[model samples]
Target: MHVLLTGASGVVGRFVLKRLLDDGCRVTILGRRPVEGFETGFCAYDLADLDPQLPPADALVHCALVHAPGKFRGGEGDDPEQFTRLNVDGTRRLFEAACKAGCRAIVFLSSRAVYGDHRRGETFSEADVPTPDTLYGDVKLAGEQALEGLCGPGLNGIVLRATGVYGVSPGLADHKWSGLFKEFAAGVPIEPRKATEVHGEDLAAAVALVLKKTGVLGAPFQVYNVSDLLLDRQELLALYATEAGLSFDGPAASAATPGEMMTDRLRALGWVPGGRDRLKTFVHSLARRGGAGT
Candidate 1:
């Protein structure tokens, strides 16, 4: 299969690109800069001003976005107009162009932000109506809706409403937990927080599954909540601290209720995450890289 992947240089997109290449698929990357050591064809352009012309492919994985540095939730800054222009409008243009380019399937990297900040004890499912609380979430939801409107006869679309994605990536050092790592290493007191998370590799696996399944194409639009763990930040940080040989007293229990994101729909298609074991490995790698002082 030939795949056109945007954001090929991003933290998550790079992993997806690796997965696609490992699966023996031809890939064409669309991004602002050329990926180092990548021999695949590349198109350098900003998503805000995307060119309609694109190489033909069997499927497209859209993951490009302009977000605030170091933050995913409500990180659009004060410029709502530019945010809409880049994320919402640019995504619409990209989806339509992919369809016109004869692509049969598209996978959008949406976010759990579309569900807003869920109340404690609330588990989100695919059936929950989107109640975005920020412009970032609102735009992501808008992009999904736009893609659904564009799908037709032979075209199919899948929206993966992913949770916080974390893992090591070459040339990408600032992950969702970068700050926590620094704080834990310095023995700074950390506040307690809780949320769901999924590894980048697992997210890529979910996307690959959707792309390979022909039955999904029969539906005009499908949405799935993709997440692996409901984690407490204090405990997670303590795991890192232990691996780093640092002393951690841990934070008080968080008053905020925790929530789970159900992935039965994606799991039905044979998607299994790396789970906490992978998380442990990730933390170990971080500790090894940063050393005991980190």
Candidate 2:
């Protein structure tokens, strides 16, 4: 299968590309910049001006967009416009182009952000209506809509409403572990909410599982919330503090706050995360970089 993946240079895209390649699929990548060491074909294209002639692919993984830890707070207005241009408009164009080019499956990397940052106990299901609070969430929701509209019921369009995904990848280090490692290594007080997390490898594996199933078709749009373990700020601080040989400040919140995701759907498909050992690797790697806590 010739799979066309956007954002092949991104944190998640790298894993997705690697997983597809491992499964013996010929993958083509489209992105703003070139990725290193990938022998597969790559095309640089602006998301705003997607051309159908770029490549012939069996499936298209739409992963390119502007997203960051705190980007939503600062780029609310400007970000939404740019996000809509890329995520919404770009998705529409690519879905159309792929369908025309005989592509039948499109897995869009959506977000739990589409449901807002409400601290509720409700486990958000795929059946729940989206109520985005931030512009980032709104644009992602719009992108989902665009893809759904363009593909209709003939293509398999799955939306993975992923939580905070963490893993080790070169040229990308600004993740949950990076911050904590910096703070702990520097002997600074580390405070991190013991929130839900998904390893990049596991996330890639989930995509691989979805791709393996040929029976699922026609914009099936599976919205699964992926996350493995949960921790609070204080507990994580204590653990990392002990690891870094430092003392931790008390936690900010006491409640066992429900994290931003649910993995029941992914679990039903026989998916399970590799757990915090992956994060420990990242934390140690960051520590080797000289900063304990950043």
Candidate 3:
């Protein structure tokens, strides 16, 4: 299959790009900059200007997001209007362009943030209504709605409401927990933090699954939850510290409300994510890579 992938230079997008390539699919990246050492193809366009016709593609995996550097939850920075214009409107335009350009499948990478923090300590499923509290969640929800409205009849749309993604990416100096690990290495008193996280490789695998089973996706618009481990900073640091032979202090556990999502829908369709084993391997890799910033 010929796949057109966006945000190919991003931390998460890099994983999807690599996974698509590994699956023997022809990929053309649509981004602002050329991906180093990548020989497939590259197309340039501003996120605010996704008005051009795309190259021929069988699938469009949209991972591109316009946000402030080093953030996604508060990515709007100080420009919420611009954020809405870029993310919400930008997403709608991109999907329409892809469908018009003859792409059969459009996979949107939505966020678990769309569910908000109000459901403290709650588990979410596709059946649960999304109650977005922040602008970020609202934008993502709006983007999913746009896909639902525009995709049908010869176009397959799938939304993967992903949780926090972790893992090393190509051409990046830092992983998601670089700060946390650095703090631990420096003996900075850590605060207890917890959330749902998935390895980048496993998240990529979820995307690949839906791409292959586009026909069996049932509805014209399908939504699936993608997540793996319920990680707590206290436990994660303990694991890392053990592997690094360092001492981690503070961050006493509390009655923190845990957030979880149901991936049974994706699992039933043969999508299996790397579980606790992968989490351990990831920590081990971090320890091996000097533990400070790897």
TM-score of each: 0.94, 0.85, 0.97
lDDT by candidate, in order shown: 0.83, 0.71, 0.87
Candidate 2 TM-score, true structure as reference? 0.85
Worst 10 residues of 3 by lDDT: 250-259
For candidate 1, the lDDT comes to 0.83
Q: RMSD in angstroms, candidate 1?
A: 1.9
Candidate 2, 128-194: lDDT as tens digits: 7888877778877987887767645567777777777777643454654666656554666544455
| Runs of candidate 2 exceeding 4 Å displacement | 50-52, 67-79, 152-154, 170-175, 190-194, 217-219, 247-260, 277-294
Clashing pairs in 1: 185-294
- What are the runs in model 1 whose C-alpha is more than 4 Å off? 216-218, 290-294
> Would you list the clashing residue pairs of candidate 3?
none
Highest lDDT against the true fold, candidate: 3
Question: Quick one: best TM-score, which candidate?
Answer: 3
Count of backbone collisions in candidate 1: 1
Ranking by TM-score: 3, 1, 2
User: What TM value does model 3 have?
Assistant: 0.97
